[model samples]
Target: MKNLDLFDPRSVMDSDFSLNVSGGDSDFGFAFNDSNFSDRILRIEIMDDAPENRPDSEGCTSIADWARHRKRRREDIKKESVLDLTACPEEQILNCDQPDMEDCGDCGNPDEEAVAMSEESPSGDEAGNSNDSCWSMDSSTVVRVKTLHISSPILAAKSPFFYKLFSNGMRESEQRHVTLRINASEEAALMELLNFMYSNTLSVTAAPALLDVLMAADKFEVASCMRYCSRLLRNMPMTPESALLYLELPSSVLMGDAVQPLTDTAKQYLAARYKDFTKLQEEMMALPLAGVEAVLSSDDLQVPSEDAVYDFVLRWAKAQYPKVEERREILGARLARFIRFPHMSCRKLKKVLTCNDFDHDVSTKLVVEALFFKAEAPHRQRILAAEESATFNRRYIERAYKYRPVKVVEFELPRQQCVVFLDLKREECVNLFPSGRVYSQAFHLGGQGFFLSAHCNMDQQSSFHCFGLFLGMQEKGSVTFAVDYEFAARSKPTEEFVSKYKGNYTFTGGKAVGYRNLFGIPWTSFMAEDSLYFINGVLHLRAELTIRH
Candidate 1:
C-alpha cells in the first residue's frame, strides 16, 4: 500500500485510483487496494484542446486560417530575405575529399595507375618526365618578379597608368607616360601634381611644390590648369628669383589667352621684386608698336605711379619714331600761328616751321600763310601799337592825342545881363553926386557881359566913383553878376574900381540923390556867341572859338 501526498506530484502519479474506494480492501477480497493494480488501471485523462484546435475566435479563429496566415508571413519574410542576384556569381558545388574512394582507370592519380603502366614508365613518367638539361638551365636562368611595396594606400589608389609607368618593369625608352619623371629634384612637383589630381587642392605650405606643379602643368600642355596655377602664384608674393625666371619666358607664352591674366601677374611680380625691370622692359620694347600699344592700353597694365609709367612711356615714345613725328606735325600746325618771330629759329618755332619735316621748305611757307591768315584788323592794330610804343618820344605822345582835348574847361559862364534906370528931372542938379551913395543892383547876365559906370561930385570936396561888372551863367542858364567899384578925388578920376564882387547877385538900393541909371546888354550882342574872351579896363577882348550852331 502507498500513501499518496497531494503536495508531491510524483506521489500523486504513483497513487492508486478508484471510483469511490473506502479506507482499505473490503472483506469480499475485491483487492481494490492493490497499489500496483490501481496504478496500472488508472489512466489520468487530460482533455486540453490542441494549440491549433483551441477556440481562437478573438485571435487565430481556425487551424487552416492560422496555417494560411503563417504561410503568407513566411512568404513575406522570404521575399524580404531574397537578394538581387544579378551582380552575384553563380553558386558552385564543391567536391569533398574522400580517402576511401578508388580512383577510376581513366584518373591520372599516380596511386590509381595500373601496375603494368607504372612499371613500364621509370621515374614516375605517369606523373610527368623532367628534362634535366632544361630544368638545370631554367633553374639557373629563371628571373623572379620583385614584389612592389606600396608605402601609402593613397598612392596605391592612384591611376594604374602612373603605377605601370613608374614600376620596375618600365624601361627608360618607354617612360613617356608622365609629363616628366619624378627625380629628387622633381619629387616636390610630382607630389604637388598628384595632390591636385587627387583632391583638386593646391598645397600652399610648400612653395617649391606649388611652383613645381605650375611647371608640370605647363610642361603637360594643360594650359587651363596652368592658368589656375598661375593665378595661385600670382596671389602669393613672388621672390626675385621667380620674377627673373618669369621674365625669361617667351612673351607669347605669357601673353596667350589662357595666360593673359598671368601677363599682369608677371608684370606685378616684376614690378615688386625686381629693382630693374630690364628684362621685361626689353621684351616690351621688342614688341611691335601696335602690340606695345595694345599692352599699354590694357587697364591692368596702366600703373598709376607717374615716374615709373612715364619712364616706360618715354622709352616707348622714343622707340616709335613715326608716331612721334605724326604727333609733332599735328602739334606744329596747332601752334604755328601762336609763336612770334626772331625767336622763330628757337626750338618751338623751328618745330612749327619744319611741319614735322613733312615737306622741305613748305613748313616755313605754311607758317607765313598762317601768320597772314591770322592778320585781322585788331591784331594788326595791336602790332602797330606795339611797334609805335617800342620807342618813347614826346612827338609820339602828341601825335597820339592830336584829336584829344588840349585843355578842357570843367566850369564856364553864359554871357547876358539885365538893367534898370532912374532919371533926374529939370532943375535937378546936373552934376552927379556919387558921395555916400549905396548902390543897390540886380541883373540877369549870361554868355558874356560887363557893367560900366561914371559919376562926379558937385562940390569940390566930393569924390569920383567908377563901377564895372561881369556876369556868368549856370548849367540851367541862370545868370550871375560880379561887380567892381572904384572911388577917387573929384579932381582926378581913375578908371580902376575900388572893390570887386564875383557871385550870383540880387540888388537893392534906396532913393537916388540926383540921378541914377542902370543898363545892360545881352552878352551875345557885344561878344561873339562862340567867342572865348577876357575883360581889360572896361572892354572885353576876344580869342578864337568855334560854335556848333
Candidate 2:
C-alpha cells in the first residue's frame, strides 16, 4: 500500500481509471465515531475490484491470508511507514501523526491548512527555493507508488480522480493507504504518467510508450496525460508506412481527442499512399473497415485510375480471408460498393476478373458493362441502380462515369481578381485587359494579339459586354507562360468561389490562343441560362490560375 496523496485533479480527471486513497493517515486519524468504524467501513482497498479488496466468498484471497501478506509486506518496510507513505517523516506533521498531537497551523481544520498550503504552491514558479514543497511532502501525506513519492495535496489538487477518492464517504475515503497495481502494459509508461502529475513535465523520449501512456491516461481519466501523449505522437518524425499501427488502435483507446494526432498522421500517410498497389498490401489489407472507409472517401487519394481502387479492394478482401476462400463474395458484397467501376482502365478491369477468384456479381457486371460502353464503343454507359445498394453506391456509380481528371495541373494563384462578363455583352471586340495586379504575357491568335488578364473595373460599369473574360497566366515582358486556369460566373465573388472555379483553360499563350475566346462559349449560350452570367447589378467573375508552364 502506498500513501502520499497524488494530488493532481487534472491528471485524475483526464484518465479513465486510477488507483487512489481518500483521507491521508492524518485525515483518517481524526478520532471519528468508534462505533461506526465497523468491519464494513474498515475493509480497505487497493482498487475496488482488486483480488485483495474483495471478500473470501467472492473467491478472492481470504481476509486472514490478505492480512498476513500485508503484515509481512509492511514489516519489509520501515516500522514508521506501516500506516502510509507519510509515516516515514511524521515529525513535521501538524501534530496529527500521534494520537495526542495538537494542530500547529493557523487553520483550525487540519484538512483546510493542508489544502491552503497546496493551493498556494511553494515550487515550480520559484526554482531558486531550496525547500520546494514539490520535493518535500509532509511525510504524513505522501503517496507511495512502488518506490516513487508524490505529494498528496498536489496530486489531489491536480487530479479530480484523486479528489473524489479522498472526499468523505467514498469507499476509499477513510483508508490510510491504497496500492496501485500497474498492469504489464502500463509498466513502461507509469513514470511518464507520474512526471506529468507531479511537475507538468513529460519527456519527449516517452514517445515509444505514447499509446500505452494514452490508454493508461484514458483509464485514469487523466486528460493532460492524453494530451501530452497525443502531442508526442503528433510531433514524431512519422511516415505513412509507420502509421499503420496507429490506424489499428482500438477505438476504445482513442479517447477525448487523445488519438487525434495519430489520426491526422494516418490520414496524411494513407492518402499519399493510396495509389501505390504494393504499399496497400500487407499493412493496408490489415486495416479495419473504418480505416478502409477513410482512405476511400478522400479526394487526395492519388491513384492513376479507379482500377487501383478495385485492385486494392480485392487484395484487402483476399487478405482478410486468406484461409476462408468462400468468404470473398460475402465480404465483397459488403465492401465492393466503394469501387468506382466505370472509372477503371480497361486493362485493370480485365486483370481483376481474370486473376482474382473472389466474385462480386454486381460489381463484376458493372465493370464488364462499363468496358463495352466506353466512348469509342457501341453502347452507352450504364449505372448501378439505386435499389441495388445504398445511396453512396449509386452516387459512386454516377461519379465513376462522370469523373474527369483535370486536363491541366492546378496551382494556387498569388491573389484573386474579379472579371465581370457584363463587359462582354458587346456583339464584337468585347475587349478587357489585366489590371496589372496580376502580370501578363503578350501572345497572338487569328493574327490578333491577346494577353492574360483578370476582371477589373466591373464595379464601375453599369452595363457592359457579357463575355470579355481573360483567365490564365502571368507574364513578364517577352516570355509568355502557359498556365492552367479556371473561371466561374458568380453573383458576387464570395469566399466559396475559389473552390468552385468550374471552367478550365490550358493553353500556350501565343499558339494555343485559337480557343482563347476565354470561355469560348458564345454569349447566347450563357444568355439562355441567364442566371449563370448575370445577377444583382453586374455579374462578378472568379477564377484561379494553376500550373505555370
Candidate 3:
C-alpha cells in the first residue's frame, strides 16, 4: 500500500474555486481539489430554490444570481481564500463558453499548477479495502462505550495516537479494551471519524458532529480530524454565529495546527469590520495579555487614529486593575507598555500628559520624546520600541500606529527599511527610508522613526531625486509592512500637490525597495512644479502616511 500525504485542509480551501457564471445555467455545481485525497472531493450540485423557499423580494432573478445569493446565504465566503480566475489563461481555458468540463490551472491558489476537474465521488470500497490485511496487523480495542473493530494497521496508518496505543508496550497495547473518557453524544462522531478514516468521504450531515469528533480525534492525536474540523469552522462565515462558535471553542482546539483557522481568521474579520471589533472589546480585553496585545498592534485595527488605541488600553487597564489610586503608576506603566507613545501627535501627547490618569514615568518620557521629535532634534537619545508591540510582530496581522503629522520614533520594527534616495553625486541609489542611512543633515524621528529615501526600481527603469512616503511598522525588524501608507507631494507658495500613491511591498529582511518614480508622472510634476528649485537642484517634498485599512 502506498503511503498518503498528510491531509491539508488549505488545499481544499485555497485551491482555485470557481462559480460558473455562464448565462442561465443551473446545471453547474461547486468543485474542489484536495491533494491529500486520492481524487477531487464531491461536486456539490447547487439546488435551485423551490417556489416556496424563494423569497418574494428577489423578483425571480436569473439562476446565476440566485445561485450566488443562495451560496452567500448558506455561508459567508470571506474566510475562503480565493484567487480571481475569471480571466482564464489560454493554456488553462479549454473552452470559453460554459461547457460541461473546464480545467483552470490558476485563480484558486497562486501556487497551484493544475486544476482537477473530475466530479466522480470516491467510494468506501476504495478506502481501506484491505480489511484482512488490516486485521492481520492489529486487533480491535474498546474505547469508552464505543467498541471499534478496525484493522490495527489501517487505524495506525494516519493516527499517531492509535499507533502508540497499539505499538507501545502499554496496558492498552496488550489488551483490546481501551477505556476513554468521552461523553455519550460523542459516540456517533467517533464512529463517523472511524468511517472517514476508512472512507475518504464524510457525509454533509456530519457537520453537527464535526467539533465533537474533532476534539476526540485531537485527544487521540488524529491530526487529519483536527484539520478537517478547523476547515469546517473556518469555511463558515465570520458572522456572529460563527464568531461566537469560534470563541466558545476550547483554546487548544482553536490554536494553530498549521493555519490558525479561529485565532487569526477571526481577528482578520474583526479587523476588517471595526464595529464588530469594538463590540467584542470587553471580551477581547478578557483574553490573555498576549492576545489583547496582538489585537492592538495591527495596522488593520480600523481605528480613526492612535487616540482610539490609547482609550482602549486605558479602558482595559482600568478594568484589569480597578481603583489604581495608590499604585496608579504601576498599573499605568504595565498597560502603557503596549502603546506606541511616539506615534501620538504632539497635541494628543499634551492632552495625555495633563490628563492625570496617565501620570507615570513612561508617559512623561514619551511626552518628552514627542516634543523632541516634533522639534526635529539633531541627536536622538535612543531607539525606543514598545516591548509588547515587538512580541506581536512574529505572528500574522501587523500592528501599526496612526500619526499623520510629522511623527518619528525608534526603528523597532522587525524588518529594516532603507529608503533609497538619488545620490545624484554618485549616480547610485542609497538607502534613505531610514533617514539614518545618511548621518547628519538627515531627517530624524526623535530616537526611533522612519527615514526618507528616493523610491526607484531598476527593472522598471525609474528614478527620481525627490520625495518619499512614511510606512507603518509592527516592529523594526520586519522585512515588509502590512499596513499601506500613502505618499503625496506638496509644495509651499504655489502649493502644487500630486495625487497620493499607496506603497504596497514585501521586503527582504533588512532590505528596502524604492518606489522609483513616485507612481509615475506625479514625480515629474512634483519636480517640475517647483521649477525654480528644480533648476537650482533643490527640492522640498513632504510625504504623509494615511492608514486606511
Report the number of clashing residue pairs per model: 15, 46, 29
lDDT of 3 by residue, 1-549 (tens): 113222222222222321121112222112112222222111211112334333311432332343333344333222211111223222111111211111423113312333454332224352233122111112222212222223344445546544544454432243322323222333455555666555533453333445545644654555655666777757765553344344444333323462356556766654454433446666666654445554564565644445567777777767766766733664464556556555554556777777666766657876786566445421121223223335553221223322222333334244322221211211112333212122111222222334344443222443434434333232346444333344554323354545446565543234443354453444334445444323223233444432223
Weakest 10 consecutive residues of candidate 1 by summed lDDT: 399-408
lDDT for each candidate structure: 0.30, 0.41, 0.40
Of candidates 2 and 1, the better by lDDT: 2
TM-score of each: 0.22, 0.40, 0.41
For model 3, what is the C-alpha lDDT against the true structure? 0.40
Q: Write the per-residue lDDT of candidate 2 for residues 1-549, one digit (tens) a residue.
A: 111223333344344433322212122222121212111111111111233322211221332332343334333223211122233232211111111102223222323222211112223333232222112312122111232223444345444444544443333343433334332223445556655665455563433445556655665556666766777677766554346546654433325466767677776766666544445457677776656765775544555446557767766766666664555664556666566665555446566665555565654676676554443211122233334345444323322211221111122345322221111222112233222122132222222233444332222243322334444323334545444545554443341332234443444433322122334344444444454444322333444444343
RMSD of each: 50.9, 19.2, 21.6
Candidate 1's TM-score reads 0.22
Task: Report the Cα lDDT for candidate 2.
Answer: 0.41
- For TM-score, the strongest prediction is 3
